[model samples]
Structures are given as C-alpha cells and as structure tokens.
Target chain A: MDLAAVVVYEILYTIAFLALISAGLAVVFGMMRVVNLAHGEFVLLGGYAAIVSHNTLGINIFVSMLVVAPLAVAVFGVVAERLIIRFLYGRLINTMLATWGLSLAMIGAFTLIFGPTTTSIKAPIGGFAVGDYSLSGYTIFIIASAVGVVLLIFGVLKYTRAGLIARGAMQSADMASAFGYDTSKVYMVTFAAGSALSGLAGGVLAPLVGIGPTAGLLYIAKAFITVISGGASVVSGLIASSGFFGIVSQAVTFATNSVIGEIGLLVAAVILLRLLPTGISGRFFRDRL
Target chain B: MTLNRRQFVQGASAAGALATVPSVAMGADSIKFGSILDTSGIFEAYGKPMEKAHILALEEINAAGGLLGRKVEMIPYDTQSNMALYTQYARRMTRRDKVDVVHGGILSASREAIRPSLRKAKTLYFYNTTYEGGVCDRNVFCVGTTPAQQSAILVPEAIKRWGKKIYVLAADYNYGQITTNWIKFYAKQAGGEVIQADYFPLNVSDFGSTIAKIQKAKPDMICAVLVGAAHLSFYRQWAAAGMKKKIPIATTTMSSGNEHKILTPSEGDGIIVCQSFSPQADFPSNKAFLAAWKKRFGHTNDIHEIAASSYDGVRLWAEGVKKAGTLDRMKVIEALESGIGYTGPTGKVTIDGKTHHVTHDMHLIEVKNQTLTIAKSYSQIPPSDTQRVCNLEKNPNDTKQYEIKI
Candidate 1:
C-alpha cells in the first residue's frame, strides 16, 4: 500500500513537472503563434535572476524566485518583442531563424556574465516521512504551484476584459482592429505574460536542478514536446497531455530506468500526435479555453 | 598581355595561396605544443582548470629554461564541448601547425577521436585525465589514474565500513559503464554484492522516482559514479529526501569538477569519495603547488584532481624532453618509456614503462561543510588494470583498446 501511494505521488509530480515547463511555450507558440526558439533561454534567464538575486544581493529566496525573476524576465521579453520579434511576426521561417540566433546570443552573453560552471541554491524545504519512505517537501510545493498557475491563466482568459480582447484579437486581428482594440498592443502584452510564465517556471525549478549557461538546452525539447502534444487549447491540452506523458514516463521509470522512461515519453508523444493529427485537446476538448 | 577581369582575379588568388607555403615547410626554433580542450561549454568546469594548468606548467618550464634548449610555443584550440570539433582541430594541429607534441582531450571519446591521427602523424600525445582503463597505444601516454588505482582502494574500504549490499548509480556512457563494472569487480572481490546498478543518461536530472526506488531497495551503501552538472542533482535530491543519514554514500567522480563546492553542506556532507589528488592533502609538494597556484591564478580553490594531473603531465613530458636531449618523437617516447619520475602536486608520480600509464597516489576523502577532509592516503598506486591487458614492452605495435570483461 505504501509503495502504491509513492508511485501515485511520483506520477502526479511528473504531470505537474510537464505542465509547468510547458505553460509559457503553450502561450507563446500555441496562442501567440510566435514559435519562440529562445524560449529556453528565457527560462534560463529567470533561473539566473533568482540565483543572482538570492546569493549576491541578499534577497529572500521566495521573493527572488517568485517575484523578481518573473518581473525582470518579462521586461526583457518586452524589449525582445519590440526589437526583433515584431519585425518577423508574419514570416514563420524568419521568426525561427531570428529566434534561433537570439538563443545563441543569449547563451554567449550568459557565459560571459556568469561563467560556464553550474551554480545553484539549496532547496528551502526539507522532507517529511510517509509510512516507510521520506519524500521531498519541495515536490508538494511544485505540484500545488503548477495547479495554481493553470487556474490563474484560465480565470484571466475566461472572465477579464483583457482576456476577451486578447482572444478576439487572436481569432481575427483585422476584425478586432476594426473594432478599435489595438491588436499589436494586445500581442505585446500577451508575449510579456508568456515570458513571465516561463520565468516563473525556471525560478521555481532552480533549486531542484543545477543552473548553468547551457542548462536551458535541457528543457527546451521537453517543453516543446509537451506544448505541441497538448495542441491548441492552452489549459486543457496542457493538462491532458501532461497527464498522459507523465503517467507513461513515470510508470516506465518505476519499471525500468530513467533512459527508457524518457524514451517512453517521446514514443507516446509520437504515437499520440500520429493518431490524433492535431493533439488530444484538438480532438476532444475542441472548445475549451 | 592584357588580362580580362576574371583572369586577373584568378591570377591574384593563385598568387595569394602560393605565398603561404613557406611557413609550414620551414620549422621554427620553438617546439610547438598543441592543445585542444572544451574550454567554453557544458564541459568547461573540467576543461577550464586543465587549460590553466597547462599554461602554468609551460610558464614554469620556460622560466627555468626552454625544453631541449628551444622555447615551447603553445598552440591552443578550444573544442567548445563539441565532439565534431575534436577531429577538425586535431587535423589542423598535425597537418597545418605541424606541432612537435600534443596534449589535451578531456573525454575518452575525444581521446579516441584524435589518437589515431596523432599516431599516424608521429606526434607524441599525452592524455591527462582520470578515466576508465584499458587504452593501449604506444604513441599516447595516459598520465591520469585509472579505475583500478581508485576503485580498487575505494570499494573494499567502503564495504568494510558500511555493509555488503551495494547499489550503483552511474552515468550511461563508456566511462560510467566501465567504472560500474570495476565497482562490481571490487565489490565481489571484497565478498560483497551489488543489489542493483542503474545507468542514467548524462542529461537526466530528475531523481525523485530513483530516490524512492532506492529507499525501497534499502541497500547497505550507495555507489554513485554519476557525472556532469545534471547528475549533481542526484545528491541534492537524495539529501532532500532525508536519505543521506539513512544510508551511507560513496562516489568516484564527485570532486573532479569541484562539485563539492557547488553543493551546499547539507547536500554534500558525509559523502565518501576517492581520487588521485586533492588541494587539501598534507604533503609538502601539495602545499607548494597550492601556494604557487594562489600566486599565479589568485585562488587555489579550482585545483582539482584532473588539473593537478594535467600540470604533472606537462612537467613529466618536459622531464622526458630533458632526458632525451632531443625533440625527436621516438627519442622522447623512449626517454619516457625509460621510467622517468617526478614529484609534483600528487606525490611521487612515475611513468609505468610497460603500460604507458602513470602510477600515482590516491586518497580517501569525506566532504563536510563544502570542503574535502582527507581521511586516509595510499601512496604510489599503479595502473594495474591497464597493465594487465596492455604491455608495450611485449607488443609495441598493439593499438587495440581491450575492453575488460568480468
């Protein structure tokens, strides 16, 4: 019974892990249609912000991770959107190339500033025992934060006026502009919000992993896989695909090892995409926000 | 003759190309020392310190006097932690630069990639990092401590202190695979058994499920051969789960990149490790090396096991050149094979003639409060693992790296 409970907890943690890493990319690529090749670098910037602020400037770890990291990276997003992303919006191939170059530049800049070695801070929380096993208390915090972030995104998009304008703009920018909504301004704000979400994910995960200049490369593929597998509906697709991939990967991990577990995830994503053509939410949750 | 625009351009380009042939043909008075390492990517934690060691050794040698009465010219190429660059730069160093001796390659794959080219080019090579054993080639000299020198001492000691059942977690590559086999061999030799051996790809960072599985297995001790920044999380996650106190831990690759400093005390404390060198040893040579390093680099914290070996590698090669009294490749190899010894940062390092590998000291260490505490030291341990399969004295033409099977 204790073993079963531990497995379930691991499966849920995996789901939360996928959902958190994919949230920002879902907004940027799924909603905004930007195909941000620099999304991983944005996440890395958030991690660095948290580490630098906490270790050097003596900021509280929580405030540094949750508040300063997102705010600082969001401002960087605004500048990046204004300078480069705005020019290549309609051209898909150009956006990919430009953002790819931007990613390289960010890695170089980070190496210059922080050096190439890995740096990290200690996890704020400790472990608590459950039956025969002790689990990291930080894992529970990550799972809860992932749920809260998803609901917040849903609430804003479903209920607020900015959410309505953003949705309408995404559906038909010409029509929304004709209604005097300033669609370009809407895009700018939306991109900033997406960047903020990625920053938050990075900040939250910094303690659990090592932070380095190339650390961004580690998560970019996993995030892209989860976001693409999630399909067009930001929240529901993310939840469904995260649930599916997380369960498959963790179950395999329990059975075998991490290498095969990761392989299981990639295999499931390929099969799911081949079967549904779009994604899980594309077929099932067709109208979900 | 009046030339057309295309003919004129072609003639000018041909002249430009023909003008650069003299430098390659005419050898300079200085002996070129070619170095290739990954100084700026994910592997920089290891590569950067090794590069610094090379420079320091060269400066010290030149300060005393040039090797073979000629100045040593360093020709460095940064591979940027990419494997493809290894071949490209190796070719350039041998064919274009025509260096006299080459020294670099951090990973085993990188060493294998360029070993053949250097051997064919007749340029002497020195690989200076602790790695899995069983590399046999007469053209190359491996100066790092091999698995036998380390795990042979570490495993039995850990088993006696802890218990018989061991769990092995290793990075999933040639290094990790071979090292895990060595651990198993040593464990069995000590009348112990390995309960489970898990291999993780170098990039797999999450260890929650692995930790839970380990708790369930409940081994007497955990042997971690995990590598790189990503694998460092295993220690953090293990500690976060409160398993550090429950089970004793032993490692073979922890402080190779100075990971003990990167990890907090709560995460890294109480883990036992064995390696060829550490900055905290109590030897006079080690103290002098640390003082010299502080004087030159302004800090002594970055001097890890491999960096010390790298510095020793350069000085040992210089000793060979001095003994040979010539820059000829065969003469220098013969000199090195004559069993030249040096007392460097690591105590009493000497070249084993038959295996073309080094014999050096290994230490047992424990991490506490982000510093290594040296508990015990074993002097002049040999590359016995490689020596078993490789004997250059018997078969000088042997170029095959025998994969040792248990």
Candidate 2:
C-alpha cells in the first residue's frame, strides 16, 4: 500500500480503540459518581494477563482475552468497592487520594513482579489486502467488536427491565430505593460492567500496543480528558469526544511533531472546558440532572 | 594494701600500651566503594544488572588480596531511577555513608542530575555509562565511549557504504538531540548531507505518520537514536509499513542488552546498531566475561554495553588504586590520568589522561535471526576532546567546555 493509505488506516484504528476506553470510563462515572484513578491499572492487568497466557499456555490471543478480561475487571471491582472506594462514595477529595495511591501502588507492584520490560502479544488474525491498500485483520476486528459492544450495551440499557432500574438508580438512589429497587446490587453490577469494559479494551489493544508497567500513565491522562470533555453522562458523549479528540490529535501529529500536536490539543481542550463548566455536552443533560 | 595498689596501676598501664599496638601494626586501612543505581523503575533493566556486575568485580578484586592490601568494601544504594532520589542517595553515600569512591548511573539525564551533588561532596564519581561527552571535572572520571567515539566511527562507515543523503529520527531528549548533532557533524565531514530530521516523544507507539514522512524524504539511509521498547514498536511499524526495503536504518544509541530481548528476532533483523560492546565481539576477555555472566545469571542474556563498561570501571579503579599504593582520592585520580590500557570485556581500553575519556574499539552489529552478528569493528577513533574545537586538555577542570561538543 501507499504511505497515505497506511497512515489513514492506522489513525482510524487508533481512534476506535480510544473510543472504547472513553466509553468504559464514562459509564462508571455516570452511574457511580466515582473517579477511578486505578482504572488504567485494570487495563494494564488485563494486557499482562493476556501476554502471560499467550507466552506460557500457547493459547491464541482471542481465547486468552476471553478468560483474562472478565477476571481482571471482576477482581478490581470487588477489591476497589470493598476496601477503599466504599469510603469515598460522597467525598471527592477522599476518592482522589485513595485512587491515586492505588494507581502508584499498582505500578510499583507490577514493576517488582514483572520487571520493567515491554511484553507483546501476537496479532490473532493477520493482515489482509484490498486492492493496493492493506489493513490489519485485527484492527478491523477491534472496530467491529467495539461497535457490537456499544450496541449491546445500548440495547440492554434501553429495553431491559434491569437497565431501567439502573438508570433510575443513577438518577436518584434514594428515590429508586424508595420505589423498591435494589440500589446496592445495581451499583455493584454497574461497577463490574464498567471495569469489564476497560479490561476488554485492553485485551483487544495488546497486539496494537505493547504492554509495559508504566504504559498506563500515558493512556490515563488522555482517558480522563475524554471523560471530562464528554460531560460524564451516557456513553454517547464519550463516543463523540473520543472520535473528535483522537482524529484531531492524529491529524495534528501528521501535520507537525507529536509533541506540538499534543500541546495544541491539550491547550484547546483546557480552554473549552474552562469556558463550559459542565462540559461540551452538558447542555443536553441539564433537564435530566 | 599499698603494694596491691601499685600492682594494679602497673597492670592498667600495660593494658593501655597493648591497645595501641594494633594501630602501629596496621599502618593504613582499606577504602570503601559506593554505587547508586536505579534498582526498580523504567531504567532498572539497565541499572539492576549493572549493580550485579559491579558487585562481581569487587568480589573478584578483593579475592585477589584487595587493592593496595586494603579490602574494598562496596556499598550500593537503590536510586529507584528517579533523579531526585539519585541526588539524595549520592549525597548520603558520600557524606553520611562516607564511601571513598563512587560508581554507577544508567541515563545521561540521571548522570547530569547527580553531578552537582557529586561535586559538592567532593567525592570522586566514576561515571560508567556511555554518554554525549564534553564533560571534564576533577571529581568525575568518564569510563564509557562518548558520541565522538561511537558516531565518528559509524557515520563514516555508513557514508562509505551508502551515498549519504541521511535522515535523522531521534527521541526528544538531551541524549537524542546531542547524539543527532554529532551524526550531522560527522556525516557532513564525510561529504554527506542530512535531508530530514524529526523528533518524537519518548513514549510514542505509532510511527505510521513519521515513517510516511521518512519515505517521502527518500533519504539513502536513516539514523535513529530511540531507546528501549519504543525502538521495538518503531521497527515493527516501520517494517509493516514496508519502508525497510527502501531505507536502511542504523542507530548509535538504540541497541543495548535489554532491547534485544524485547524485540522479536525477525522484527530486529537487518537493523545496524553501532555500540562500544557486542556480545559476539571476538575477544578473549569478552568470552570469559560472557561465560562467567551466563553461569551466574542462568541465561545467555546479553550484558548491556554500559554494564560491561561499568564492570571495567570498577576494575580500572582498583588497578589505579593498586598502582598509587594508597586509597587517597587525589592519588587514584592521578594514577588514572597516567594513560594506561586495561584489558576488558569490550577489548583493550586506553584512558586519555588529558581528555579524561576512554578510547576503545567499537563494533557495528546487525540483528540476524534474533542474534546480534558483528558487521565490523573500528579499533581507533580520536578522543572526544580532539574532535571538538576547544582544547579541553588545557583545563581539565573546566565545566563550560564539556557542553560545547556534547
């Protein structure tokens, strides 16, 4: 393939990956009102688990992810809720400190256990060619799987009885409980689902990006920016912001240097966020809030 | 009763006299050696093994009856790969721990960061890592090859082989910027011109756009100075982009012991890495070093260029101390400045007393089937001070001249 086509294909694939991460973060925040600083660690855990399984058991990448993704997120959800996150339900300051500490501790623990080295997973499906343009089969799979997940989530929330109860609980916990809803169970399940989404995203992304202990630091900042810009509402705001930010950043990097591109995007985002206190999509959710 | 008192006084005097006898028996004492390194962080892959090598060298020397008949006690501290922590640990080693000599540092930034503390404490700092060198300090003895030693040999050979319309891709940091400058200078000297230059952040994963620009530039060869796993990512993406056949890639700083393990054999093939040491270099010293290393570490993991250099640094310091017949810091410094050659794992290394830089053989290696094969070895390159415009020999203690060439 020619160079231009290759660049376009890579940028699209990266955007789709970012959108999945942002959507996962948006769901948890929207329901629980908890800022999960340890979210990136969970992603790293899933990636490492997949890498270990691939190297040791000789399992295919997709098969490994099927086992790793749900287990990582479930473990993280239970530990986070029981040990620390429970105390920070209403206190933002407490949540910030506890989660930030959790993030650092996780980084240290992983480095000690795994050593500071980069690990990779082989692409499950190889590349395919269409005319003069070549595309990675794994990249296409990532895009399709993410879309399917989003659609599945949208359906569950819109049509299922459990989905209605979840929406009601997020809007008003006391009112939902007064209406005979099991708010605690709903909260637990929502947190687990959000964590699971992050794990799934990491598993799919292991081949595209190599996993390192400190790799989570880079993604966490961008994910937080996407979540804040999207107004921490339903997954729609997240999907929109992820696409917008990813494309802008990639295009700017193509036009100039990556450092300059990052600076420009971050500066613009910060200014827009300051001007709009609630966020870019805040106006749409004003009546609901 | 009076007789008993007199006997007691005489006995106490005799005991005091015996206590001072050992001091006279042993006139001098052994010197202490301290090392500060990142034991757990991003750079630990380089630093941890380096610490192990230092300890091994110390054990070998002390087993041979110590330096100047004084046992060498090594005290090592983990810097955790943080710059602030490096300074704190370095100071604590010199002032509180009172080590007579110091060694160890992996990153050029970390080395530069700890310089002030090394100076203020007046402890002799033996920097063991290869760096972008122009530094000359009374307290600092650089044992690794500078950019001049590395690039002066590599660039000319590259230009001789490929008509040098060169392209530069580097990490956006001090080491990358300065090393790229050295390449540009040497490339120009060899009647070649650089067509394009680009810098990327340290953690960049995607090289699709950067590779596109490189392809558009259409240079005869590209010189890259990226380090760590980032190099692996860049190589995979570049190869997948199909730029490998069109452009030949070479790097002075990218190849290290740790990097080879991370990248698959196929991904790293055909890339040329110029370095001070290669595991495949045909030297008896290197063969022994590798054997001992594998036996102890339980794998054939290639020791990093800096780790061997650091190991050599400890041995050289021991030799200097032995030759000087004293543990006095100034005497050891004077001995090191006497232009002596030491047989080391890399090869025979000669220290330039005037420049305070070590000159040695450099190897050009190509990655083939997951193994580093030697392409060629350049035995001699001018010391860094001679290549630069300034005369560093006139003032060995001058700090300003260190930045000019580096």
Candidate 3:
C-alpha cells in the first residue's frame, strides 16, 4: 500500500511535469501555429534567470523563480518576436530555420554568461511522510503549480477579452483584422505569454534538474512530444495526452527502470501518432478549450 | 614571368601552403609537446583547468632551464569537447606537427579516439584523468585513479561506518557499470550486501520513482556512481527528499568536477568520497602547488584532481625524458618503464610499469560546508585492478582495455 501511494504520487508528478513543460508550446504551436524550435533554450534562459537571481542577488526563492525569471524571459521573448520571429512568420520552414539558428545562438550566449558547469538551487520544501515512506514536498508543490497554470490559462482564454482576441487572430488573422482587431499586436502578446509560461516552468523545475547551457535538451524532446501529441485544443488536449503519457511512463518506470521507461514513452507516442495522426484531442475534446 | 591575376593568386597560395608545412617542424632545438584539450564548449569546466595546469607545468620546466637543457615547446589543439575533433587533432599533431609527445583527452571516448592513432605513430601518450581502469597499452600512461583506487576504498569504509545493507545508483555507462561491479565486490568481501543497484542514463534528472524505490528497499546506505550535469540532480533530489539525514551516502564520482561546490552545504554535507586530491589537503607539496597556482591563475578555485594529475603527467614525462636524455619515443618509454614516480600535488603519484596506471595516495574525504575534509589517508594503493589483467613487462605489444571480471 505504501508502494502504491508512492507510485501514484510519481505518476501525478510526471503528468504535472509534462503539462508544465508543454504549456507554453501548447500556446505558441497549438494556437499560433509557429514552430519555435528554440523553445528549449527559452526555458533554459528562464532557468539561468532564476538561478542568477536567487544565487547571486540574494532574492527570495519564490520571487526569483516566479517573478524575476518570467519577467526576464518575457522581455527576451518580446524582443525575439519583434526582431527575428516577426519576419519569419507564416513560412513554416523559414520559422523553423530561424528559430533553430536562434537556439544555437542562445546556447552560445548561455555558455558565455553562465560558463560550462551545472548550476543548481536547493529545493525549498522539505519531505513529508506518506505511510512509511517520505516523499518530496516539492513534488506536491509542482503538481499544484501545474494545475494552477492550466486553470489560469483556461480561465483567461474562456473569460477574458484579450484571450478571445488573441485566439481569434490565431484562427483567422484576416478575419480578425477585418473586425478591427490588431492581429499583429495579438500575435506579439500571445507569443510573449507563451514564452512566459515556458520561463515559469523552467524556473520551477530548475531546482530539480541543475541548470546548464544544454540543460534544455533534456526537456525539449519531451516537451515537444507532449505538446504535439496534445493536438488541437491547448487545455483539454494537453490534459488528455499528458495524462496518458504520464501514467504509462511512470508505471513502466516502476515496473522496470527509467531508461526502458523512457523508451516505452517514445514507443507509445509513435504508436499513438501512427493511429491518430492528429493526436489525442483530434479524436476527443476536439472543440473543448 | 608575367602572369594573369588568378594565376598569380594560385601560385602565391601554393607557396604559402608549402611555407606553412615546415613551420610546425620548426624550432628543431626544442621538444614539441603537443597538448590537446577541450578548452571551450561543454567540457570546458574540466578541460580549462587542465589546460591551465599544462601551462603552469611547462612554464615551471622552462624556468628550471627547460627539459634536456633545451626549451620544451608546446603545440596546443582545442578539441572543443567534440569527439570528431579528437581524431582530427591527434592526426594533425602526429602527422603535421610531429610532436615528440602528446598529453590530453578528458572523456574515455575522447581517449579511445586519439589512442590508436598516437600508438600507430609510436608517440608516447599520457591521458591524465580518472576513469574505469584496465587500459593495457605499452605506449600509454594513464595517471588518474581507477575504479579500484576509489570504490575499493569507499565501499568497505562506508559499510563499516553505516550498516551492512548497501544500495548503488550508478550512471548507465561503462565507467558507472564497472565501478558498481567493484563496489559490489568490495561490499561482499567486507560482509556487506548490496540491496539493490540502479543504472541511470546521463540525462535522467528526475529521480522521483528511484527515490521512492530506495525508500521501500530501506538500504543502510547509498552509493552513487552517477556522472555528468544531469545526474547531478540526484544529489539535489536526494537531499530534498530528506534522505540525507536518514541514509548516509558514499560516492566514487562526486567532486571530480567540483560537484560539491555546485550543491549547497546542507545538500552536500556528510557525503563520503575517496580521491587523490583536495584543495584542503595538508601537505607541503600540495600547499606549494596551491601557492603557485594562486600566483599564476589569480585563484585556485578552478583546480580539480585532473588539473593536479595533468600537471604531474607532464612532469612525469619530463622526468622520463631527462633520464633517457633523448626525445626518441622508444628510449623514453624504456626509461619510464623502470617505474617512474613523481611526488606532485596529489602526493607521490607513481606510474605502475606493469599496468601503465597510477599507484598513488587515496584520501578518505567528507564534505562539510562545501569543503572536502580529509578524514583518512591510504598511501600508495597499487593499480591492482588493472595489474591483474595487464602485464606489459612480459607482453610489450598489448593494447586492450580489459573489463575486470568480478
């Protein structure tokens, strides 16, 4: 029974981790249809921001992770959108090429600023007992944060005027422009918001995986896998696919080990994509936000 | 003769290429010491200091009236943490520069890339880094501690201090796998049993499931043989789970890259490690080395075990050359094969002629407040693991890295 609880906790944590990392990609790619190959480096930038603030500036851990990191990355995202991403919009291959180049540049810049060493921040939460076993309290925090981020995104999109305008512009830029909406402004804000979400995830997860210049490589494939497999709708699609992956990956990890478990996740994704090319939301929750 | 513009340019370029070829072979009076290291890119944290140590050692030699009463010149190539570049640079150093000796190769993969070419050219090579032992090559000298030098000392000592049941978390690579084998061997010999062993890939940073499994197994102690930046998260997650207070941890592969400094004092404290060098080591030679490093580099913060080893490696080769009184590769090998020893920063590091590995002092260290404090010292631990499989004295043509059978 104790083992079962730990397994459940691990599954939840995995689901939350997948959801957290994919939230921003779900916006930029799922909604805006812009493939930001540099998504991982943006996350890495956020992690560096968090570490520098907390470790060097003597800031509170929460403020550094939640506030400083997001703000720093949001500013960077705005500049990237204005300077590089703006020109490459609507050309899928060109956007990919530009962003890929941007990824290499960001990696180089990070290596120059941070140096080539793994930097880490201690997790603030302590352990809490569950039956005979103790698990990280930070796990619970992460799960909560993931849920909060999803709900916040859902709430904004469903209820706010800005979110509606942004969604409309993404769906049909010409139609939105004809209706007197500044679709260009909407794209800029939406991209910045997506980058902020990524930065937030990077900040929160920075304590778990020590921040390095190439640390984003660890999360990039997994994040892209989650977002791509989520299909059309950002919220419901993300939830559906991440739920499937999180359960399978963690259960396999428990049955065997992590390396095989990772293989199992990839295999499951391949089979899933093969069967439903449009992804999990393509079949179910097609219209639900 | 009057020539067209294009023909003139081509002739000038051809002449320039011809001129450049012999520049590498210039300075016939000095010995060309070819040094290759990843002074940039991903492995720079490890390679940068080792490069610094190379310069420091060379400058010291030059100050002492040079090797063989002639200036020992260095030819450097930055591999930039790329594997392909290792072979490319090794070939360049051997074929073009025609360096008399070569020193450097951080990762095992990097070492393997350059080793064959260096051997083919009959150039004496020195790889100064800690790794899985059993490199049985007559032409190569591996000066770093092996699995036996570290895990053999750590496991039994950990079993005595903690209880009998042990658990291992090793990286999913040859180094981690072989080190785990040695740990198991030493554990059983010391009347302790490994409750479980888990191998993690270099990029597996999330340890939630692994941590929970460890809690269920309830091992008396944990031995981490994890490596790289991603695996460093294990230490952070382990500490976060409050396991630091419950299960004592011993590691064979921590602080080699100054990982302890990466972790906070609370996270790093009480971790047991066995290595050859610690900045806090209390010895005259070590002190002098640190003093010299501070003067040269402006600080000693970047120096690690491999930096010390690299410094010693160059000095050891210089000694061999001094004894042989020649730059001829065979003569230097013969002189070094007489069991060359150098008491440098790591304290009396000697080359075992049989295995081409080191027999050196190993320190039992504990981490407290992000500092390595030496608790016990074991002097001159032989390269028994490699020596069992490698005997270059009888078979001088051997060139294979044996996997020591448990």
Give candidate 2 regions above 4 Å deviation: A1-7, A124-138, A284-289, B1-28, B120-122, B159-163, B229-232, B240-246, B300-302, B385-392
The residue-level lDDT of candidate 3 at B405 comes to 92
**Each predicted complex: what DockQ?**
0.73, 0.40, 0.82
True contacts kept of each: 0.75, 0.29, 0.81
Q: Write the per-residue lDDT of candidate 2 for residues B3-86, one digit (tens) a residue.
A: 688799998989977876654355336567888888777887888778888987988888888877778878888888788888
Q: Taking chain A of candidate 2, what TM-score results?
A: 0.89
Per-residue CA lDDT of model 3 for A120-141, tens digit only, reads 7889999888888888999898
TM-score for candidate 1 (chain B): 0.94
What docking grade does candidate 3 earn?
Answer: high
lDDT by residue (B291-352, candidate 3, tens digit) is: 99999999999999899999999999999999999988989988888888988899998888
Per-residue lDDT of B52-128 in model 1, one digit per residue for the tens?
99998998888888887778888899999999999999998888788988999999999999999899999999999
lDDT of 2 by residue, A1-289 (tens): 4766766765776567677666567777755778888778877777887878778888776777756765676678777777887766879888888988998998888888787788776566655554444445666787786786677677878889888888889888999999998887788788887777777777777766777888887677777888788774565666666667767777787788777768866976788689876766685554332
Model 3 is docked with a DockQ of 0.82
State TM-scores per candidate. Answer: 0.95, 0.89, 0.97
Reference-based lDDT, residue B168, model 3: 95
Q: Is 1 or 3 the stronger prediction by TM-score?
A: 3
